[model samples]
Target: MEAAIKFEAHEEVVSFDQEGNVVVNKESHMSKKLMARRAIEAHRERKRLESELEDYYFEEM
Candidate 1:
């Protein structure tokens, strides 16, 4: 079977499998600056959660 998929002009078509799965290209969608910002935000959130957990653990001791 053949299928046609339409996307925006800025969108990149990575690949389509026989199982009807559409794979998007990450590199084309995410810029280095955006990726760095996301990484930093994730790291900060992780650190905050870890600190909270540590504080709770110490308080319970």
Candidate 2:
């Protein structure tokens, strides 16, 4: 299997390439889509953590 790495910008994947090689324009679409998905997932995780912290603080009060 080829190891893949992605570069993202502005919530878009600007590039995706196998390790040790450069990615070109053709790979940009999928890379951007993956980047967007990852970003959304990260946002959700942050929200969950904040909610948990709020609950914890309230319980301790």
Best by lDDT: 1
Candidate 2 lDDT by residue in tens digits, 1-61 = 2233423333243333454233334445455676566656656666699799999999999
Q: Model 1: which ten-residue window has the lowest total lDDT?
A: 1-10
What TM-score would candidate 1 get against the native? 0.53
- The residue pairs that clash in candidate 2, if any, are 13-32
lDDT computed for candidate 1 = 0.59
User: What value does the lDDT take at residue 29 in candidate 2?
Assistant: 48
Ten-residue stretch with the least lDDT total in model 2: 1-10
* Candidate 1 Cα misplacement greater than 4 A, ranges: 1-28
TM-score of each: 0.53, 0.52
RMSD of each: 11.3, 10.9
Error of 1 at 27 (Å): 3.9
The CA-based lDDT of model 2 is what?
Answer: 0.55
